[model samples]
Target chain A: MTYCIGLRLNHGLVFMSDTRTSAGVDNFATSKKMFTWSVPGERMITLMTAGNLATTQAVISLLEERSKTLEERDPSILREGTMFQVARLVGATLREVIDETTNEGQLKQDQFSASIIVGGQIKGGKPTVFLVYPQGNFIEITQDTPFFQIGETKYGKPILVRAYDPDMSFADAIKLLLVSFDSTVKSNLSVGLPFDFQVYEADSFAMGTTRRIDENDKIYQAISEGWGDALKDAFQHLPSYKL
Target chain B: MTYCIGLRLNHGLVFMSDTRTSAGVDNFATSKKMFTWSVPGERMITLMTAGNLATTQAVISLLEERSKTLEERDPSILREGTMFQVARLVGATLREVIDETTNEGQLKQDQFSASIIVGGQIKGGKPTVFLVYPQGNFIEITQDTPFFQIGETKYGKPILVRAYDPDMSFADAIKLLLVSFDSTVKSNLSVGLPFDFQVYEADSFAMGTTRRIDENDKIYQAISEGWGDALKDAFQHLPSYKL
Candidate 1:
């Protein structure tokens, strides 16, 4: 299992994803789930994936190969004219991988399925985000729903629902994502550290700050421990039930 | 779907369950998920159900009927010698109902399955909580893990993990539960208004205060609204991330 989130904020787009993958409970490994493709000052495309590791890796590899070899028949995610077309390319790649894997075996189709979050800005389009489903369909983020999450999402959702502000700063957005990720990591073993994150500034058409946060990252530790204490204090401030 | 929690605290046992049940997203109705049986000054037991409504209703009906008719060969839940025994009887009854329902049709066995949280005390034993599985097996809550949640459990769990204290007052316990239930209600359509809760005082061998909290209840409204504000404030207090 994995936990990943994509936020569409007034400032731009914020993306974060956990790095843990497992074949079973006992076999775990750290694998980066966030990918970026950028043509400086022209376009920036970022994607975070969750679900079957093989399928996600395949999708990313296909996108990477297509971008490098411009002569290929398949469209490259980086060459797409708009964020919407990039999402379609990613979705089609995900579906193609799942179909190929499922057809080669007697196993269930869902066993090799994956979902993705694709968000960024192209030269002419507004910065945006989309949630690509395993069925190859997708939905873009709107003002009514400014965020998208995939895999192991429910544990961290309450805070996101309560605290998200579209006008929040990139620093605050990262803080929010860390708190959300901390909640998920503490509650479930399947989603662990180090986390990969990328920030994009709207209309800049270039990736902004990007980093990997591990267990020892000083700020991550401070927020993780501080959030727990803050939550307890917050609970104390609520009016107590009577009778 | 449903959301029910059985919490073991030093003062006694606390149980809360949402009332919404649905056959499909478009069809929903209110149904009580919490039940209690007590012989004053001798024993008290509270049970909460989650899963297939038919199976849970049948299990509760069987327990209610067996208790009323002493001539039945099956042991009455009210007559169980200890809380553990009561849990076993409830689990067996649940398994019995699910087995009966599945065998009568060609449907999958899991379609008739249900889970339960049973807690309380009989004269000779300590007050405890048990999470009863669909297979007629149950596990009791212990000091290390003093709570049990059934159905739609993830969204409301982080706060419980962070704020629960065994020595907290009953007033605080109810407040904590309201916070938990409110989170579920806001996030899920399958769990909603009019929550039923029962509290028991250890060694009293009788049910304590029990109430149904609806959408319009004053304190419920206060806590539900106040919690969102409190959480947002808490997020502000956390140290902001730097990029």
Candidate 2:
């Protein structure tokens, strides 16, 4: 299980993901889910994955290798002209990796199935976010749906739906993502601390901000505690039913 | 789809459920999802149902018939000596309905499957809550797991986990439930307005308080507005990330 969110704002894009992976309740490990590829001022692409670690790692390795070679895969993340093209490239690579794993009997199709959130700034296109399904299909963020949440999504979705603003500052967007992640980590065992986050300002074609939030980060601690206290206070003041 | 919750607390029990039922996004109707039965001073049982409306209605009709007859079904809900017995009776009736529907070529087992939450007070026993599965198995709420949520529960769970207290007052419990329902209602189209809520005091063995919260109820409106405002204020005050 994992929780990753990508937000498409008017000014920039925000991406966040948890790092915990579990084969079962007893076997737990930490692995970064957020990956970034950039050609300096030309294009910067960020991808966050959720589901089987093996499938995601294999897909990432394949993409990295092809981008370096530029032989069979002509349109790599590095060379894609638009964000949509980058999404298509990632989706194709993921589909190929899943097909290979299924044919090898390494895992069932559903067992190794994974979803990815692709968000980036292409040299000529605006910053955008896309949610890539396990079946190699994807959809872009729209005005009605400005953010995409991939795994363990429901527990943290209400806040995002309620508080999201298209013109929110990068700092505010990061704060929103942290609050959303905090809600998920508290309720779900599979999603935990050490969340990776990134921000990309539109037209910059480079990563604007990046941070890894751990369990004991002072600001994260303050936000978590503050939100809990505020909720209790809000509850105390709610109008009670007249009996 | 539906959303219902049953909470067991040190002082009493709380049950709340929405009233909307839909087949796909087109066919929608309002129906009661909460039911109550009591022997006045001996016992009082409250039930909330979610899932196939036909199955829940049939199960409820069967229980009502048996309680009135009291001959063939000796341990009817009306005559159950313990809260557990009442839960068992409801579970068995629900299972029988599901099985009968399955045998009649009406629908598949999973298609008509339902879940129920039972909470009550018996003359000689403490107030308790039970979550009844479609297979006729049930689990009682304990100190570690003091609540049960059925159908469309995930969106509303984080707040309950963060704010629930075993010793909170009856009014506080009702407020908490309303908040949970509010969150679910905002995020989901299946659960809607006109929620039924009940409160039972410990060892009283009779219905304590009951209310149907509608779209225009004054207290319900106040709570909803207050909670939304409070959440926005909290969001505004959260410290922004420094990059």
Model 1 Cα lDDT, one tens digit per residue, B1-243: 899999999989999999999989989999999998889999898999999998998898888884456666453776778788888888888888888877755543377889999999999899999999998999999999989999999999999999999999889999999999998888888888899888999999988999999888988888988999988898898887777
User: Tens digits of per-residue lDDT for model 2 on A1-243?
Assistant: 999999988988899999999999999999999999987888889999998999999888887884455566543678778989989988888888788767565553488889999989887788888998876879999999999998899889878877888988988888888888998888899998899999988888888788898988999999999889878887887888666
Top model by lDDT, which number?
1
> Global lDDT of each model?
0.89, 0.88
Model 2 ranges off by over 4 Å: A66-75, A101-109, B66-75, B102-109
Instruction: Please report the candidate that would top DockQ against the real structure.
Output: 1
- How high is the DockQ of candidate 1? 0.81
Residue lDDT tens for model 2, B156-218: 998999899999988989999999999888888988999998898887878888888899988
What is the DockQ for all candidates, taken in turn? 0.81, 0.70
Model 1 CA deviation exceeding 4 Å by range: A66-75, A104-109, B66-75, B103-109
